[model samples]
Target: MCRWLAYTGNPIHLEAVLFRAKHSLIDQSLHSRLGHTTTNGDGFGIGWYGHPTDIPFRYRCIQPAWSDRNLREAARAIRAPLFVAHVRAATGTPSQETNCHPFRYGRWLFAHNGLVRDYPAVRRDLMLAIAPELFPLIEGSTDSEVMFYLALTFGLERAPVAALERMVGFIEETGRKHGVGEPLNMTVCATDGEQIVAVRYSSEGQSRSLFHSTSFRHLRDLYPDDPRILAAGQNAFLVLSEPLVDLPGWWEAIPESTAVVARGGEIEQYPFTPELA
Candidate 1:
């Protein structure tokens, strides 16, 4: 339903990963090999932190990413240590700027790559559950935005993984109550400037595509002489809806019903479930 990439380490120009990689996020907008659809041109967005405590800067548009002149110029000029880019293919919702991905709130930036089946049928129930404070902040009619606010209402800032787990659990339970099949297929990425938490799950047990890169240090050791790897940080890591390149050992798939947390150079994985109160 969408394509996204999250990068942490090395304050390289956004183009380094958004456009330079062999199969960059820009290219994925038109040639995604692992997403549910090959072309995710509905809309796009990019969010990045200027400093650890600053609210993330974001740009979202209703136009296709490849055709956005501002995005092209900005990609070349903006640089950051951690950021997220997403190209969406709206699932029944209007294709508008607010409906684009990489949604932001406070210091957090979030994007998703799948949907809540029968979202329309359950949209009201889900929205009503969000805390009143966050309810007015939702600016779009997409399931992705709803999911973001849901995480916030459930305490993402204090306990990200658990909040998200509870959100998914609530979705599955709500979906089943509405007799909706294949409740969800979501590969979500979120960052609060310092650390990132990514989740992969689906009620059907088979999720949409998602992968994370090996550390720049490990890649350099493997290819000893690969100069590109030399320019990256020892902790440079990338999480994507699809591999940025065809390089072997460059990426690893996050297991189904699991969440991966990356802070600096340390990464950890935790089992996930689709059931919530």
Candidate 2:
């Protein structure tokens, strides 16, 4: 349905991954190998964190990722310790600025790569579940935006993982109530500048393509001459919809129904299941 990536570690210009990497996010926007579609040209977004602001700065537009000069310039200029980017392939939603990826609130930035199956039948039910105070924050009609707010309503500011589970559980339940089985198919990443949480889950078991880069130390050993590797330090980590390059052993696939957390220069994984109870 879409493709996305998240980065955390030392502060680096977004251009490194979004443009300079082999088969970069910009290239993937036009030639995605693992997404539901080949080109995610409906819209695109970037959300990044810098000093002195708890909230992230966002840039979203309804332009093809490859044609955006502003995005290219911004990528080279903006540097951040943490960032999220998304290339959207509109399932049914309009290709509008508000419908782009990397939605933001407070210090949190989120991006998704899948859909809520048969969303129209379950949209009302899902929106009602969002917290009242946060409901007004919903600016887009995309299911992805709703999912972000649902997480917020379920305490994303505190218990991120648990809140996500609850959000998924509630969506699954609501979908079943409308006879729409298998309502969720998503590989999403959320971050608060402290830690990044990425989940790959689908009610039917098979999820979209999701991968993460190997450790910086390991990568340095593999490509010692690479300046990017040296600049990223030992903590450089990337969670992507697919590998940034064709290099094997550098990117690992996250198994179905799994959750990954990147923090403190480390990666941790755990079983992920919707909490219906």
Candidate 3:
């Protein structure tokens, strides 16, 4: 399991959410409260969309986020309209740079907080399912990276939600064929430099924890004295594996087995089920 945060709103320094929050993602990397492991020191990564290009800039390394000096430096210097950051606690894979989260393809960025159970048993089937053209794009051995390419193979560019559903369905179907009782447990976030889609789901119905912040304007009002909220764009929204701060009414726990789409300051939630196609 792991911890991650996705931010889309006004352009602000990455540190504001990655390091400066009350319980920032960097803090979670070392002392996570809700993750399976308290220390996610395997590795970390950050991806953000900057101007002049639709594609995101990514910085990933197999270093603990809390002690990475370059991460601290970059977080303070870079600002973007949207970004995704992750700290990894390798479930069954080695801690390698390519295995870090916020995996990217073209204009898309993705990260996951859970695993595909019995991945080794089902890995070959899932890998073969990926379109050959897209297969070469997979650079890591983590189930998370495979899931990303699987979604891409299933048409993530055209329909993110549907593609992801199909991806999970494929994993679940393959896992069951290999006798794995529960195949999927994930809180996933994906973005194409515009709209962001997040899903909290599992084959067994015990998905990991996920939270989303209220509108920035509303949060500013709720915590008038908090400079961090004041600095965020009015339309900014944050979705994370856990609450970055303890401000009441500022964070909402997303229901299990749910999909949340956040775009243009509006957030919508819908019941999530694997498409099984």
| CA-lDDT, candidates in order | 0.89, 0.90, 0.90
Which segments of candidate 3 are over 4 A away from where they belong? Answer: none
Segments in model 2 whose C-alpha atoms lie over 4 Å from true places: none
Clashes of 1: 1
Off by over 4 Å in 1: none
Residue-level lDDT tens digits of model 2 in 1-277: 7889999888999999999989899999999888889998998999988852478899999999999999999999999988899999999999999999898888888898889999999999899988898998899999999999999988888988888999899999998999987889999899998899999999999899999988889999999998888888899899999888887568999999999999889899998878862
lDDT of 1 by residue, 109-167 (tens): 99998999999899999999999999999998989899999989888999999999889
| Cα lDDT tens digits for candidate 3, 1-277 | 7999898887899999889888999999888999888999999999999852588999999988999999999999999999999999999899999999899999999999999998888999999999989988888899999999999999999988999999989898899899998999999999998888999999888889999988778777777887777767788889998898886798899998899999888899998889786
TM-score of predicted model 2? Answer: 0.97
Clash count per candidate: 1, 0, 0
- Positional deviation of residue 217's Cα in model 3 after best superposition, in angstroms: 2.9
